[model samples]
Every structure is written in structure tokens, then in C-alpha cells.
Target: MSQSQKKIHYAWVVLIGLIVMVGAAKGGIMTTGGLFLTSITEDLGIGMGSLTLYFSIASIVTMISLPIAGKLIAKYNIRMLLVVAVILEAGSFAMFGFMNSVWGWYLFAIPMAMGSVIVTQLAGPVLINNWFKKHRGLAMGIMVAAGGLLGAFLQPAAGNLIASEGWRNTYFILGLGVMAVVIPVVLLTIRMTPQQKGLQPYGMDEVKHNETIQVEKTANSGVTVAIAKKSSAFYFLIIFFLFDTSIAAFNQHVAPYAVGLGYDIKFAGNAMGSWSVGVVIGALFFGFLSDKIGVKNTAISAMFTGLVPVGILIIEPENPVMFVIATGLYGFVVASLGTLGPLLTTALFGNKEFSRIYGLAIMGLAVAGIVAIPTYGYMFEITGSYTNVLYAIFIMLIMNVGAILLAFKGKKKLEKAGLWN
Candidate 1:
């Protein structure tokens, strides 16, 4: 078949590239950080908090890099950027095998965060929008499933690698191995725009060739960024992001927590896999629930689900099976940041200035990571247990409930002011 008449469009090919690159970046490298923590801290005689401070450093770098990444993605070649991004991210992970001190993690976190903000955070959605006009949600769902599925497999494999080869070689293998796989995929199949392939987006067949969604017409009816920034609702949403993300950031500690409770690293790995499974199921469930009920209820429901896991951990994590199941439940809650964050944004302010408003509010995510991850670590270090940490998560879940409530009230104030068109 001719290029235009081919059975599958190049957009799908680009999506294949995205699945490989994102899954490797997220599933293979980033999400596995916790697996190495116990070994590193125990081997080096570093405090868990002191060693995991790298997470805070990475979050800081990510926060600083976010706006710059969005601009760069808009202006640069997506393929070249992704290839380079994987190197910075995975390269840092590989080099961790060479480090002898806490300073090594603190130092390498810079490049890792810079690469991560692009590869894992921004690329999938942006590329999907540029390629799939119809079935956009399905495209995103597919990409998310790739991450969860890959992580499910990789988590246990990573645990086994760490058990056999040690954390050092596991780091090197996972890091360099992923770079080896993802680099070529990005170079070969990814593109910034469908225009590069001389074709329209996949769904354009149903509409006039020249017609595009009237984004401007819809955008004009929502809360403006300037107005949103001034509203109480925006600040409430920021608080919600901070609280919710702090809860999510605990994923990085799951392996350590399991190990601390006398489970082996292999069990921790299996637990992390269950978490990945939860992420997959939770994303689907929240999306469907939101469509059925509303963003507000779905978000509130997310906070409540978090309570179940925390309750289990605090009461009794003695059963390995139950612990894994609880971790999976928390993983379901972890997905809310992705599945509900955007919906909450639109539900509050409409679409008038979504990108800008969300960009600003999501600073809370980075800020939360900077504080929460290390806090969990230090709490473990100081107390010799994660009981206190789990209790704090319980409180935060309650706080998130209040934040969600206040955010809707703030939305009401905007509508009452006649600012909502």
C-alpha cells in the first residue's frame, strides 16, 4: 500500500515509540528507585533520610525545569529531545552504581530530574494530542497501561537482580539497559508533529480535512488564568495537590518499608508490582467513576481509598499477602494525581487557561515531594519504624477531603462573581 493508503498510520508507529520510551523511562528506571534504597543505606551506613535526600533534590530540579521543558518541547525536535532525555535520566541511574557516598545521589539527581520532567511527565500527553485527535482518551489510557504493565514485570525482575547481582550492578543493568533500548526507538519512530509525516491526525477522516476543534471558542468560556490565580479555589487546589502528592510520594518507600518489616527485597518487589497493577486498575476506575458521577466525587473517593491502606498498615501489616494487597490499594490512590488532577482542574476553572493554571498549581507536586519523601525517610530513620508515617498519611487524607470541599466552594464564588462564562 502507498504511504497514505497504508493499513496503519505512522501515528500509531509514533505511539509505539512512545510506549517503549515512556515505559522504559517510567517503568524501567524512575519507579524502581526505592528498590535500591535499603541496600545503599545499609551498605554505606547512611541514614535512610540522608540517602533518600536525593529525592528532594530531584524534586527541586524538576520544579525548576518544568516550565523550561514545556517551552523546549514546543520548540525543539521531539525525537532528539527524548533520546537525550533518556540518557540523562537512565545515565544517572547507571552511574549510581559507581557512587560511594550520599553526595553521589544528591549530585546525579540534577540530571535525572531534568530528564524525567521531559521523558515521563510531559512527552506522552503532548505527543498523543499531536497524533490522535480521535480516541485521544484511549491513546492516553493505552500509554498509562504500558507504564503499569512494564513496571509490574520490571519490579520483580529488579528485585531479583538486586538480590543476585547487588544494588550496584542492578542499577547499572537497569539504567544502561533501558537507555540501550529506548534511545533507538525514539530516534526511529517519534516525531514532534504529524505534519512531519505529511499526513493529518488519525481521526481527521470523520471531519472536514481543514477543520480543527474550535479550541478558542471553548477556551473563552472558562476561568482566565489571571482570575484563577486570584481566586481562593486555585489556592485550595494547590493545597490538594500538595497533600495528595505527599501521599503518592510514599511509593518510593514501599520497598524499604517492607524490608523494615522483615520481608525480603523480593517480596518488596512483588509488592511494588502489585502497586503498579493498582495504578493500572485505579486509573481506569477513577476515569469511569468520574464519567459516571463527577470529578469531585471521584477525587473524594480517591482520598477515601487511601484510608483503607493506611488503616491496614497501622493495624496489622503482619500478613505478607495483606501487605501486598494494601500496597496495591495505595497504588490505586497514587493514580489520582494523574487521573483526577486534570479533571479537577477543568471542573474548577473550566478550560480558559488550563495549561497555565495547572502548571502553576502543580508546583505543589514538586514541593510535596521535596518535603514528604525525605520526611518519610527521616521518620523511619529516627523512629526505627514507619508507624508514625502511616498515621500521618491518615491525617493527610482527611486534609485532602477538606481541600477538595473548599476548592468547589471557591469555584462557586467564581461563578457568583460572573467571571465564569
Candidate 2:
């Protein structure tokens, strides 16, 4: 074989490794966190509100760390950054096993959030954008699907572990497992870009340096952050994210919610697993659909589809089959949000300063996390039911639909003004 044929495009390999590490870490943390909530509260003799506050602290930390983490990733070596991130994330998680009080959670949540922001949120998008030119959206969708798959498997397993071995041992085992697997993967596979391996992105015959230049020029043509902030589109996008994220807060609570409804913990875990299955299917389908149709249509469809599950939950809380269907359908909306959220930003604003603008816009997700999780928890504490939150989610779903419409209006305004091409 010739040198070109023989040359290994290791970036794609790196993408796969990153996907696994991200999947394991996120699946362990986000999907499994609620499994421990009840155990932690009962063991420590704490109120649900108090334990939920730790989740709030984690959100605030996630918001604070994101921009700093973005800047660090840009400035530092990717390998070193990931190493630090894994240590913080997995190590903080492991430390949860030893905690005797709530204060431990509040303190350790800082590092856990910091690490999570790096691995789960930043690394996938940045690395995929750097490595693949031709099928970036598909790459992102696959990466997210991997995480969902892992969540589908791990959530039930984690719940079973907690049921049998107890929460502390589960935390120790999971935390160590994430660090052990991810650290080595990051060291061995991940790199900054394809250029580091002296190759173009997968499937490219030649590097179109000029095409890249033109695309950059178009992306940077006129949309400034200042100008973007002035548009109704920006605010609409924020509202859309906030509502969408608030609805997504349901995932964290699914296991506990199931228990609240008098189901077995294992059954709850399986339901959450079903949720991830829906996420996997939705991410792949909606991602491809967005490419075929338009981001606007895809997003509007997703927001409306999200409402179906809300109705199911409201009307049929006691039926396990209905609960599973509702959570799974909810997962479909979430899958779209994961894929379409960034795509919509790029579609609406172009990619000139995409990182900065995307970073700022996604802070709305953190804001939603900060408000939504605790609010949901407290509502349950006060009302002994999620009915109020469900009603609120329905209202927010309507608002998200409005937000998408407004974003299109803003896009038209930009195009008419010759500010967007």
C-alpha cells in the first residue's frame, strides 16, 4: 500500500475512545445520581430539599466552570486537560462514598461539576468539530447515542448494585471504574486534530483549505456577539433552552419518581433504561432529519413531540407501561435537544465565534439546571406529587414552540438586513 493508504487517521479512533469515556462518565453520573438520592437521604437522615440543594450547587458550579473550562481547553493540551477532568470527576464521585454529611457533597460537587463540564459537555463537540469536516452532525449524533446506550445499561445496573451492595460501595466501584477506563483512553487515543496525525478528516480526498477559509468568512461575515445579543432570536433561543432543559430535569428524578409511585427500584431503573433507548433512537433520527429538512422544522417538531409524554404522565400515573412510554417519549425530545441545540445555533448565527456564542447560550442550560432540579424536588416535597411540575412543563413546551417561531423571525430579519447569508 502507498503511504496515503497506509497512514492511520487516528482522530476517528480518538473520537470513539472519547465517546466511550464520555458515555461511561455521564451515564454513571447523570442517570445514576437519583438512584442514590433516596438512599443518601435515608441514611443521613436528611430532607429531600437538603439533598437536592447539592444538585443546585453542582449546577451553579457547572455554570461557573464552563467558560473557564472552555478557555483552558483552548489554551492547554487536550490530554492534560482530560486527565485533570477525569480525576476531578471520578475522584470526587468516589469521595461520595466516605461522606458523613451534606457539606461533603456541596464541596465535592464543585470539582465533580468542573470535571463533568469538561468531559461530557465540551470535549465531544470541540473534538468532533476539529476531526470531521464532512459528517460533523452525524458524528455528534453517534457520540450522544453512545452515551445514551451506556446510560440505558448502566442505570439499571447501578440501581441493582445499590439495592444489593448498597450506595456507598456502588459509588466507590463506579467512580473508580470511570477513572480507570477513561484516563487510559484519553491518554492513548485523544488528540487535538487530524493535522496532528498528518492526515485529513475521514473520507476526505484532500484538505480544502480554501473551502475552510470561505466557510469561515461566511460564518464571521457580520454577526457579532453584541449584534446577536440585540436580536430577539438570541433571547428566544435562551427561552427555548431553558424550557427544554427544565423538562429534561425529569431524567434525573425518574428512578426516585418510580419509587415514589410504589414501584421497585429495579423496575424504575429499567424505565430509565427505556428512556435512554428512546434517546438513542431519537438522536440518530432527528439528527439525520435536521440535515434533510431544516433546523427550525426539526426543533418545532421535537418541542411538540415532547408534549405528548407530558400528557401521558398527567393522565396515567399509575400504569407502569404508560410511565415507560411517557419517559421514553420524553427521551425523544431530549435527544433532539442534544443534537439540534448546537445545530440550531450554527444555523442561526453561523460559526465565526461559534464557541463563545455557543458557550454563552448554553449557560441557559445551566440556569435551567439550577432552577429546574431543585424546583422539581421542592414541588414534590410540598405537594407530594409531580403534577404541578408536569403542568408547568406543558406551559413551557408551548412557550418553546413560540421561541422557535421567534427565532425564525429573527433569522428573517437578519437575512433581510443583509446581515446573514
Candidate 3:
């Protein structure tokens, strides 16, 4: 094919791979698995605390796996890695069907967490950074939004399957489905770098002909992983990730919060679905906005917008319409995890050592999973209300805006010292 005929960039193919693979891993497995929680506990006659501890175990594993996953991604074939990742993740999920004891979950949580770190957490950001130089934010947003869109349907479907076929069959079906769909997509579309396809990343026409020049240019604009690890910018990003994850953990408590307010379980599910809608819209909006107004500004706007939902939850929790709106708005802001997080990293440090740096930064997410969820639950247990937790989230939201500003300031210092080069 001539150049004109071959004009469809392969970065988009990689993007499609990312969307399908990550979305399936997240929607098919991670997001919808909660539907099986009550069923599994009830069927197996396990305590809720005992059964749920497996998720905690998975979080700890995820924390330890992030940096190791990053190094492996840098060294291995992207296609092969993702294929193995999906099998481990989805396969273990399928295995959950056969176990009569809670110990099975604890044992399988190891591989589950490992596989998930690669497919769900690492792949989308790393691959997008590799494949798209321009419109990177938009690409990240689309990937995240695709998960939201998929989960919007998948959650309901999983719920119905659990209701009709029992949790065991539903577990097997979801695991098999994810592996069937995601592995093939990874094989077909994913590549470690544009060079493998003899092309440049999207929006890299000016540097298309020279790989050496491309590397040099990008390296000069960013700090190395070593320098970034020692810098305040890095610490600030970690703090931001922590607060972001902690704040968003409130989503898990939303159903309970609603039930506390006298809403039925069905309404809670519907309300959570509304939140998914916000996720889709916000992902796209923040991505496009980051491209237009820049990452820093877009982040500040998100933090400000986040306050609205928290306020609604605090002051008007009983108003069903407002509750849905607030939850949706909160999900919209949560889109930042998929959108702003990576983009901000790139903006602050460039793409020179992006995978390594991002891998380290996201440890905060894993840590939050361990700390935040239990903290929220504990606070509610002690206080008999989410009022304190909501107030704390409000303060964290404000702190997030400050962290963004401080991180940018740290970036300026790095640039001034010529450490970026």
C-alpha cells in the first residue's frame, strides 16, 4: 500500500487493543466481581469480613507488584505479557467457581493481583504514552471512558447472571469471556513500540524518520527515573494518587450509605449506574479539556468540580435525584485517575522514563486500597454516619488542588536545575 493508503495510524490500533483489553479486564472482572460478594459469602457460609479480606490481600499484592510489573513491561514483549496477564487474571477468577472454602480466594488473590497490575493498571497508560505523542490525554480519556461504558452494561449483566445462574456459573462465564475476547485483541493489535510496525507514534510526523532524534528530544525534556524518584514532584504525585484513591473509595461505600438513608438496594445499584454515566462523560471531557487548556488547569477544574458532589452527598443525602446527580458528578471527577494521572506525569516529566516513574507513583493507589476502604468502613462503624467521612473527603479535595500546584512548582525547580535534561 502507498503512504496515502496506509495513512490510518497503527497507534489507533494499539489504542483499540488497550481499550478492549483493559476494559474487559476491568469491566468483566474487577468492576463486576462485587456482584458476587454477597452470593459467595452466603453460599459458602463464610463471614463477610473473612471473605472480603481476600480483596485486601489482593491490594497488598498489587502494591508490591507495581514496580516489578514496570520492569517486566520494559523488558518483555507487550503482546506476550498481556496474553499471560489476562490468562492469570481471568483464569484465577474462573477457578473461584470450584472452591468451597474461602482459602481459595486468598491463594488465588496473588496471581489475580499480579495479572491485574499489568493488564488493568499498567498497560493502558504505558502503551498510550508509547503510541501517541499528540492527543495523548484524549487517548487516555477514551480508554478510561470505554471501561465506564463497558461496566455500565457489564455490571447489570453480571448482576442478572448472578441472580439467575448463581455466582459460580457467572464467575466461570465472566472469566472465560474475558480471556476469549482480550487475548485475541492483544495478539492482533498491541505492540511494544511504533518501530515494531515501522511507523512513528501518532502526531510524530516531524520526527518520524529518526528514532535516535526522537529519543534524544524526549529525554532532554524530562528527568530520568532516578532523578524523578528523588524529587518533590514525584512525592507530590504520589500524595495526589493516594488522596485521589482514598477519596474515590467512597464509591464502595455508596450503596451502604444509600441503604442507611432508607433507599433500597435496587436504588443503590441504579444510583451507581448513574455514576458510571458520569465516568464516561467526564473521561472524554477531561481528556479533551487537558489538550485544550492543559493538564494543570484541567486538574484544578476537576478538584473544584469534585467538591460539588461531596457537598450534595453531605447535605442532601436523602434526595434521590440529587443523590444520583452527585454520584454521577463524583464518578466524573474519578475519571481523572485514568485521564489526568498519566497526562500530568507526562507534562511534568516527559516520556523519557514514563513507565518506571508511573509504576512507582501508582503504588499510592495500591496503598490507598489497603488504607482507605477500611478507614471509611471503620469511621462509619464508629460514628453511625458517613458525615465525618464526607467532610474528610472535602478537605482532601481541596488538598488535591494544592498538591497539583505544588507539583507543578517542583517541576519548575527541576527544569531550572537542568535536571530534566
Candidate 4:
């Protein structure tokens, strides 16, 4: 019996594996890293500016690595690469438990960022693109939402652990623990492509049956990498990546933001938990909405929708309930970075050399994080409030609306030039 003809497609198996590995990497390590800010700074007597500066270091490394990582993921053996990535990410994270100086963070930040660049940033999107012929948006959403699901559980638990077990111990336990679980799952489930299982992508049959869609030709169609790189769509994608990532980078500061507002760690933990819940729901929403309403409209609506949370944060952040609500809403906006980033990439550039194009374009994330994360930290440290930061985020959201429209305009130019097929 052919795999695609079975009751379940193998792509679902690939997706399930991604959900576990990416979820663990994102939820257990990446998102949860922010939960340690307050405790680590206070306990170690490190300045907020100094510790968060490590994020800048990490971002720089990620930026430099992304293009190379793109080529490597396309060319390398999937299982080998993923295993090493998890170890680099999780191992570096666990080693944080032993650091006594800020330089330790700076040092480990290198490998950690390298690992996460593959594990957290690139893997799910690349794999889903490879494995799904249709419903790509939904698969991306579900994988991202699963990260949220793990985050919804892990964030609070890590918070409580920090309270009970100390930051060092919590770091070791979470890092090693998630690594332990994720490595085996990656080995068992992830494949570079569906062709490995002697099966076509999920929904390939349906795509072929639909006359207008033109399955094989459509799959082969798209601008070459050189053409895409020179196009206006590429530039707007960089802007979109920058602003969207800048919005999401606020996650690293959310806990500290709450504490600075006079909320305790417990409240901050729950707030992170709320953000995770929003991520799960919002991821699915963006995925479904992108497919139904189109990525451009959905991206525009997301920017406007983001303003509500920023407004609430600016106006009434002191209210405990409202603050958590704002964080949750913020999470919804952040989910777009995961669910919509790749979708937008495909929409603008088509899927040709998607790895390289998407990799190069989303370096804006690295650029944004390097500037934004430490900027947010230093802003709070200097002003003793996130007021300006929230206002800044508001502006970024507005700018992105313009960026999205212009990006599509750029796409039209490519089509007019006879590059895009």
C-alpha cells in the first residue's frame, strides 16, 4: 500500500516530529530564556543591560550563520544536522547553569545561537515546505502552535522552578531535559523530504486533480534566487522580518517588564503562560486566515490587531489582569512571525531556492534582535519604564503595514519583468 493512500499521510508524521523537536527547542529553551532575566540579574548582581547584551551577541552569530545554515539544511543529512543542533542548543543552555561571569554568557551565546538558528528558526518551516503540497499554512500553524502548547506548559513550570530550585539549577534541568527528549524524537521522525518514504507530498493528489493549479509545473515555477534577491519584494520582506521580529523580541523582556510594573515572578510566570496560550490560538488563526483571506490581508490585519495590546500596555499596564491580557495579545502578534513569515516568503518569492531566499531575507530578524532586545532592556533601565518601548513597537507595527503593501507591489514588478512564473 502506498503511504499517501493510507489512512494517514507520512507528512503528518514529519509534522508531528517537528512539533516535538521545534516545540521543545522553542518553548523549553528559546521563549523560556526570558523568564530568567529578573532572577539572574538580581541574584548575580549583573546589570540588566549587561545580561541582555548577550542576546545581541547571540543575534549577531545567528545573522552571520543564517545564509550558510540555509544552504546546509538543504544539502546536509537531516538527522545528523538536527541531532547536532539540539545538542549545541541544549548543551549550551545547560552550561549556563555553571557560568559565573557575564563573559560565560557571551561565550556560550555563540554555539547556542548557532544551534537555535537551525533548531528553532529554520527547521520547522523548511521541513513543512518540503513535506506539504497543500495546506502548507495549516501545517506551519500547527507546528508553531505546538511550540505554543509546550510553552504554555513549560513557561510557568520554569517560573515555579526558578522560584523553588534557583536559576542555575532550573537552567540545567530544563536544558538537559528537553534535549534528552527532543534528540530521540528527531532521530525517529524527521526526514529531509517525503520522497524518502517513497511517497509524494500530502495533498499532491488533490493538487494534481485540480485543473487550474498545475501541480508539477507550479511546483517548478518561481523566480530564481538571483532575481528574487534583486527584487523589491525581497527588500520589503527584510522590513517585514525586522519589524515582526522586533515585536516578538519583546518576549525576552516580558517577565522583566511585568516585574518592573510591580508584579511578582509568579504573576510573570502566569503571564508567560498566557502568552503561550495566545501563541497556540493565534498561530492557528493566522494559518487559517492566511489560506482563506490571503497572506497580505492577514498580515495587514495582524499589524492593526497588534495595536490593541500595545495600547493596553501603554495605558493600563499596572493592572495585573490587563497586563496579562496584553501579553497574551502580544503573543498573538508574535505568532505571526512564526506562522506568517514563511508564508509571506513563499508568496513573494515563490518556493524556488526558498531556503536561501528565506534565510537571507529573514536575517532581518537577527538585525532586529541585535538592536531591539538590548535596546528594550537599556530603555527600561534608563527610563525605568517600557513606555517608550511600547510606543516604539506601535510605530513598528504601523510601518509594517506599509511594508507589506509595498512588498506586493514589488512582487508585481517581478511578474511584470517576466522573472516570476
Highest TM-score scorer: 4
lDDT of 3 by residue, 304-341 (tens): 99999999999999999999999889989998887999
Model 4 score (lDDT): 0.91
In model 3, where is the ten-residue run with the lowest total lDDT? 206-215
TM-score per candidate, in order? 0.89, 0.93, 0.91, 0.98
lDDT of 3: 0.85
**Candidate 2 lDDT by residue in tens digits, 1-421:** 3576676566669778877878888787766788888888889997777787877898899899878888888899999999999999989998999998999988998899889888888777777766766566777777777778888898889889999999899999999999888888889889987888786666454446667666545534547676778788888888888888888887877777888999988888888888888888888888788778878998889988988999998999799999999988888779877788877777778766666667777777889989998888889889988888899999998898989999879978987887764
Measure candidate 4: CA RMSD: 1.4
**Cα lDDT listed for each candidate:** 0.85, 0.82, 0.85, 0.91
Residue 146 error for model 2, in Å?
1.3
Residues 1-421 of candidate 4 have per-residue lDDT tens digits of 4653656888999999999998899999999989998998988899998999999999999999999898889789989998999999999999999998889999999999999999988988989998997899999999899889999999999999999999999999999998889999999999998889987888886553656466787885788889998988899999999999998899999999989988888889899999999999999999999999999999999999999999999999989889889999889888999999999999998887888888899899999989999999999989999899999999999999999999999999999888888
Poorest lDDT segment (10 consecutive residues) of candidate 4: 205-214
Decreasing TM-score order of the candidates: 4, 2, 3, 1
Better of 2 and 4 by TM-score: 4
Candidate 3 or 2, higher lDDT: 3
Looking at candidate 2, the ten consecutive residues that score lowest on lDDT are: 213-222
Q: Which of candidates 3 and 4 is the stronger one according to lDDT? A: 4
For model 3, the superposed segments whose C-alpha errors exceed 4 Å read 1-6, 38-50, 99-102, 206-216
Q: Which candidate is the best by lDDT?
A: 4
The alpha-carbon deviation from the true structure for residue 298 of candidate 2, after best TM-score superposition, in angstroms, is 1.2
Cα distance off (Å), candidate 1, residue 260: 1.3
In order, what is each prediction's RMSD in angstroms? 3.2, 2.5, 2.8, 1.4
